[model samples]
Target: MEKIGTIASIKKEATIYKLTNPFRWFAKFGATGGLILFFISIVALVWANSPYQNVYEDFKNINLTFSIGSFVISKGLILWINDALMAIFFFVVGLEIKREFLVGELSDIRKASFPIVAAIGGMLVPALIYYLFNQEGDLRNGWGIPMATDIAFALGFLALLGSRVPTSLKIFLTALAIVDDIGAVIVIGLFYTETIHLIPIVCAGCIFVSMIFGNRLGIRTPWFYLIFGIFLWIAFLKSGIHATVSGVLAAFTIPSKSLVDGHLFVKEGKSLLNEFEVSFSKTKTIKHSQNSLTTKQESIVATMETACEYILPPLYRLEHSILPWVTFVIMPIFALANAGITIEGDLFRSLSHSVSYGVIGGLFLGKPIGVFLFSFIAVKLGISKLPEQTNWTQIIGIGFFAGVGFTMSIFVASLAFLDSNSLLTNSKIGILIGSLLSLTVGMIVLRFQKQK
Candidate 1:
């Protein structure tokens, strides 16, 4: 009894340590991605300004082709990254969005109200601010550019504040960002695009139906979705709606529920373990010889694999495996491919442009006001109460943090402008300036609050 108690105490201490440092693991994820982005940005800046500038330009301009019989898909490297690979990114984003809505922060109406209302205000106010300044012709279409929060950068910044920021505050920000991402997706699908073709649209619809059926049928393997999702992506790309929209659609069709619940999983798992032990005991192993283990070992291994299959949720598995790849490889490559903006004489002229001003102002000014005001109103009306241990000052600081719109803002900027060069430069300038200002102000304010 004494030994068992000591063992249990040791296990409890280990569990506590793991729980306390949960953010450390996630922080490393965000940090690695940020580092990759930083290095890529540096390389791009150098390459764009170097004697090899034309090489860089020509590389991006290089036409890539994909053809199936009479249907040929051709685009520049930049477009491929923005339209194709970024679709996978959006698909992952969609998965996160769905999970949050179904079971995470946005699951309960009262719990969701603060972030949902804040996200709405955050999106609407920035868009309105952008539209007010850029109401000229095609520039009016760029209003969505400022309405996004870059979760990676924002979370990374929050993590840097250590325990000064409450855990509840971080949760609030994360939830708000997730809601903000949903709004961005809707805005992109609805407002940002042009004509849509019916044939491809029908094809996409059919694929979606098939995916739904797969979910209903308890199909667990990822291969079916991957193959069909590629086809759906192509169909959507051809349909003239952005290919990235297909990612969101595909993610929506993925089954969030496990085939077996946790209670059943544990019961079945223990049964499988007992069976495996029985099988192993039947085959007496002499010096751990492979021949001694025989067919029983193989059977036990298979049973263990089956048990794992039943126990692990597909959504959890997918998120765990793909998250590292998406953050480090895909996103960094995207930044490298897109972040290069050749600074020229007309750079100042581009800065003076309505699109540039709209993006900068919307992110810098609109995000905080929108987030705070909406949150305050929601709490006041009793739709949602503030997170426990979080004050208004912390909320305002988080609002500022929300304005650090790097990833999604750049993505929207790419879609918003027709002329790539002007868009790229303006977006880089705006993201740099707005993100810097938001970070500086948020940090200073939070520090002041802590001191007080």
Candidate 2:
């Protein structure tokens, strides 16, 4: 039976994944929030180069501290944005990754092959391009910047095209972007991390392991994971590893299994329906009460909430609950904090520097070439199949969109050029230009393909 179950799992699952519920939130609210992010970015740019630049600079440097007994955290506003708020963003990404592997597009190996293979190509070719351009010196470290494809921005552009997009294309893009995020996390955790503090790392490991044990023990409460996860994050922050990685590590320990199994859920649902019918017969509703639920009805309704939780679990609930905040608030704050590059006279020259060239080449040229090339080869080799109803033209269009590497690319740039203000500015120029170009070209192709 186990062998049969494994084989069945190997087979492609049905297209149960849809742009509904929380995914819909990412589409609708995410797109709206993407617009907010863009506006905030523009505000940052204007404020940075304007006469008020010093004020903005001063505001960012204001030291904020919090303390509890002997323990305290002291950081600037920028650190709070990069190190703290972005950690929540990564947490949501971790939850999505967990869900994807367990039951989404990535559940079946064969089905997962298309995006995983394409994401590999997408990452490698960009890194290689950046390396070729800047292999001589310090700028080589920024290669990972181009390897990201911001899922929110990419999907926001797709959402703009409305019914013109094929559902398969949406699924493919989402899956590919998620895989791309996994690669970025790996790169940050490995190459970008600096000097390590082993003591803190060991401390974090012990707590993380305890979280896993808690999951195994059927401890489904969220507080245990979250409170411990905070300790783990702080440990990583001190350990010289990026604190955001702790979120991903914590996410793996979240129980994917529900309290109620599918068959049991269905059976319970039918029993509840019968109970509802019986209760309705005995309970009288007042017209002035506007069909107010009777005591029996209220009791049944309350039980349904528990059943819903049984079906969804805390992992999904947390992801769904916080996604809007991440999109609407945290992401915009990140943009406002990080996107304010001073495009002064000398800074414009820096836009033509080596770091700029490498990043632009990698994102604008390398991204499309690599994505399309790998996906084409995968289909040809029979390793994966094309998404339904999507032709080569649409595939090419999707490849272009894969180059829109804004959020994660900028995040990586902050890591890569943590100290060099000049190189960081140059890299930001490349990211902004490359991403805008991808958006412009991708939209034209996807929107007008039917006309052609």
Candidate 3:
């Protein structure tokens, strides 16, 4: 009986560990979110063009307001989706950025150089391409729009290619996207906001100080950071800077260390488990009343929770938790609200505009050339080496795949032109056309390579 019980215990432990593996968790979350986003986008497109178009517009325009005591905040439903919910998205991005720099692919300069250089080229070429077409107009601000890589879309597309694409290539693509996000965040912070308030800026600074101090004081509870993070977000919103930047700032301050010593956790956990066993024997059943358990059982739960808190790291925990919200809920709603550009018979006329040409050229032409050329230079200079299984052909194919810039391009297009309705319409057209082209071209190239 004792031997049988030991075997059962071992099986249960193995099952628990398998369920909690981080890689499986990430892949599951990412896959589920991607599917949700894809369906949401389809629904949005259908609804926008449906007989209930007015209802769609009205829903997006609805004013949402919340007040506490004397303070109140109000925004259109669209703005709430973009500014508030997307702030959480950016916060998760910031956490990913911090994690990569600290320990992931970006931790080693040698490993990082290829993607870093490629990202710079990817960003610069797109901006230059956009500027060349819009040098004389307000459409210039839209240059950054095509510079982003929608990792979800890109990775999803890659997944369709199956074993044809190498694992190294996927890692490279992910790293490049991470770097691209950093650049986009910088641009948004510096160039997107139009007004400024000094008081809120100062308040943000104070909150930042508190966050740093909290980390220094070894505060491990997530609640400590969450409360002050809200304050930081409010301050940045009141200031001229975008509120999302506060998310990035707060992510940087999360403590990475464990509260209790590792040895203490192990020793105490074992002692508690021993006590739990004796208590379970007394009960003569697998179940014990919650109230009947001694303080040791409660202590075990607390210790285990604390150990998870420390082992997982808050930045990673937040990223994992928030990814689903960003991909499934926030991004889809943003698309539904923003992607409803009315199509008319004059869609061709819109496509002939300078904004259209800039967006098309930047994404379709500039992205591939820039990413490939810069990566070549980095390899030549011995700053970075290409992954072993990746060839020049694969690199070029990946470059084209990088051109699918739907989300970020649309976002920047909104910010870039105010009165140029024709320009905005054309830019969307360009994005659709260019992204489709890239997808087709990339798949063909990859398929051909695989056949060889």
Candidate 4:
């Protein structure tokens, strides 16, 4: 009896520790993802500028095709990465957005206001700055380029700062980035879309409505959403709506409610676990050389697994399963695909272009100014308050961090300048330069500041 009680207590403690120590887990994930992305980007850049530039181009232009009966889908490697894989990325973003609005930092109006307003400022000011520099021509379409905040990269930098960064500030930056994501999604859907096909749009609408119906019907299985979500992506893909938008829409349909209550789960889990423990002694008596569990013990374990699944909401489960893939695999592949740009002669001369200037100026100069200015005004106007244990300088640092708009900026650039390779190359150059500057300056600002 005493041994059983001790083992159970130890298990409970282990579970509590895991739940309470998410920061370390998240920090490792962010830093690893960021490093992988950075390394991949560097590799792509080197590969593009080397004598093998032709090889790099060939790699990106590699055509892939999938067909079924009368239906066919074909695209170059880069387009598939940007259009198809990114939709999965956007789906994860959508899940985070929904969770934030439902229960995370954005759940409370007062808590959400600071980051929300700051995000608006961060997005608008950079875009306006980009537009100002490109106001003369088609370059204005690229305004969306600098308005993104790469959360993975930003959080990775923050993780490097370690103990210097306060938890409140981390929360502030994360919330701000999530809001920035929402803005990006809206802008992409509204402004960046190409010509629309009504039949596909109607099909997408019908599918989306069915997804909502499924949610209302209390369907908690993730496979249901996953299957329908693929169809939704296909519909949006055919609708000319930049298929990634479907990711976000499908995310909103995932069931956020868990099937089992927390209390009931704990009760059942303890019972099953205790039963398994008792069966352990019996397994020892009938021991196989492989150390396999007895049938009764296996059944108890299976029931426990089911209970664990029931206790977690599908949205969380999906996010947990998919986020690691997005971070480590999809995003790094994206960086590899899109971060390469051939630079000829003088780099400064390349930067001299008005389009390049717009991107650099918008990201480096405008992002910090916008974030700080808007937040300051909100504080002064009593619309929002600064995060606790944080100061003005830290907010400025965060604003600069927001300027590290790598992944999404590159994604938007691909769309904005799809027709012109020269323009696209120039934009990629600006993105790389601007993001580097943001990362460095943000580090300097936050690194030197003392916590209050």
Best candidate per TM-score, number? 4
Instruction: Kindly give the number of clashing pairs for every candidate.
Output: 0, 0, 0, 0
Better of 1 and 4 by TM-score: 4
Q: Considering only N, C-alpha and C atoms within 3 Å, which residue pairs clash in candidate 3?
A: none
RMSD to the hidden true structure, all candidates: 6.1, 10.2, 5.0, 5.3
Candidate 4 per-residue C-alpha lDDT over 1-452 given as tens digits, one digit per residue, 9 for 90 to 100: 76688789899989998987886666456488888789999999999999999999999999999899999999999989998899999999999999999999999999999999999999999999999889866788899999999999989878889889899999999999999999999989999887999999999999999999999999988888889998999999899888999999999999998888889998898888888878786666673533467678778888988887888889999999999899989999999989988898898888999889899998998899999999999999999998899999999999999999998899999889989888998899999999999999999999999966
Off by over 4 Å in 1: 1-30, 274-285, 289-294, 346-349, 447-452
Better of 3 and 4 by TM-score: 4
Model 2 ranges off by over 4 Å: 1-30, 285-292, 346-348
Across 259-319, the per-residue lDDT of candidate 2 in tens digits comes to 8899888998889889998877655443333247777778988898789888888788888
Worst 10 residues of 3 by lDDT: 29-38
Please rank every candidate by TM-score, starting with the best: 4, 2, 1, 3
- TM-score, model 4 to reference: 0.92
Model 1 alpha-carbon miss at residue 74, Å: 1.5
lDDT of 1 at 407: 74
Best of the candidates, lDDT: 4
> What is residue 36's positional error in candidate 4, in angstroms?
1.0
- Give per-residue lDDT, candidate 1, residue 224: 86
TM-scores for every candidate against the unseen true structure? 0.88, 0.90, 0.86, 0.92
lDDT of 2 at 419: 91
